[model samples]
Target: MKKLCSVMAGCAVLAMLPLTAFAYPIDVQKQLNGLSIDYNSYDTDNDIASIQVNNYGSTDAICRVVFNNGPESPRTRTIEVPAGKHKNATAKFTRTIIKMRINLTCTPK
Candidate 1:
């Protein structure tokens, strides 16, 4: 019974490993032309990151999102956000990301 309990505890610890992982930091730089644009950045995975753009203005807008990871090429994603709508942009890097830097530029479409 003691051996079984020890095995169960080990299994529990292994299962909790995924939950112990914390997200990396994300930095966002934005240039919105007087539009009500809001954005949220996320560290999706070890080698992936994403941004969610929310447009609360009355006009449609075009947005460009760039994701940069250390020692890897920057990834750029261009998206259109309709009025009162939102969109998501994601990028995957070749290596595990320690920190993410994002540049966001939006203009009326």
Candidate 2:
């Protein structure tokens, strides 16, 4: 009876392990679109901005970010991340245009 109970308990623990180990899916779309930039105080000589994105998914994801109304030409880049986690990227420019906006796209495999 004791051995049987021990074996059953072990099996139960093993089943629960997979459930807890599962990782959430990365939602890059929401992070990219939800980004907000504040330009309340305007200065002609100096302008700075930053953006961050977090990835939560079962697998790694690639992110492509684009910045519009930046001081320089528009920029795009891709990043890779692992499962059950998140990563962030930043963009900076000296020039500030009215209603600055950033667009991001994430792809997971």
Candidate 3:
């Protein structure tokens, strides 16, 4: 019985781990990290929250965004932006753009 309980506990912990992991292209990640990002503008047309991500660097870049509006108010998820010199993205919530975090995890090319 003790062995079974230990195994169950291990399984419970593993189940609690996040299973939603997105793997973007490696070459794109390298390109994105090499460039710098510039905040352009935000748009909220037709109840959709969208923002522009511009790469001010000399090369292209890849980036991901995470929206954090409020606790239990808007459940946002991680979304990858377009792989290019510049792109636009829409978040789950648009009421407050400050809560959004842009993660630029790019490797130097």
- The lDDT per prediction is 0.94, 0.49, 0.46
Clashes of 1: 0
> Over all chains combined, what TM-score does candidate 2 have?
0.48
TM-score, structure 1 vs. true: 0.83
lDDT of 1 by residue, 75-100 (tens): 99999999999999999988989999
Instruction: Show where candidate 3 strays beyond 4 Å.
Output: 1-34, 43-47, 73-84, 93-109
In model 2, how large is the Cα lDDT of residue 24? 20
Model 3's alpha-carbon lDDT is 0.46
Which digits, one per residue and each the tens of the lDDT, describe model 2 over residues 25-73?
A: 2112234332222111222222333345455545566667665553477
Which candidate order results from sorting by lDDT in descending order?
1, 2, 3
How do the residues 22-58 of candidate 3 rate in per-residue lDDT, one tens digit apiece? 2212111112444566544343432344546666565
Question: What TM-score does each of the candidates earn?
Answer: 0.83, 0.48, 0.41
Q: Model 2 Cα displacement at 92 (Å)? A: 1.8
CA lDDT, candidate 1, residue 105: 98
- Superposing all C-alpha atoms, what RMSD in Å does each candidate have to the true structure? 2.6, 17.3, 13.0
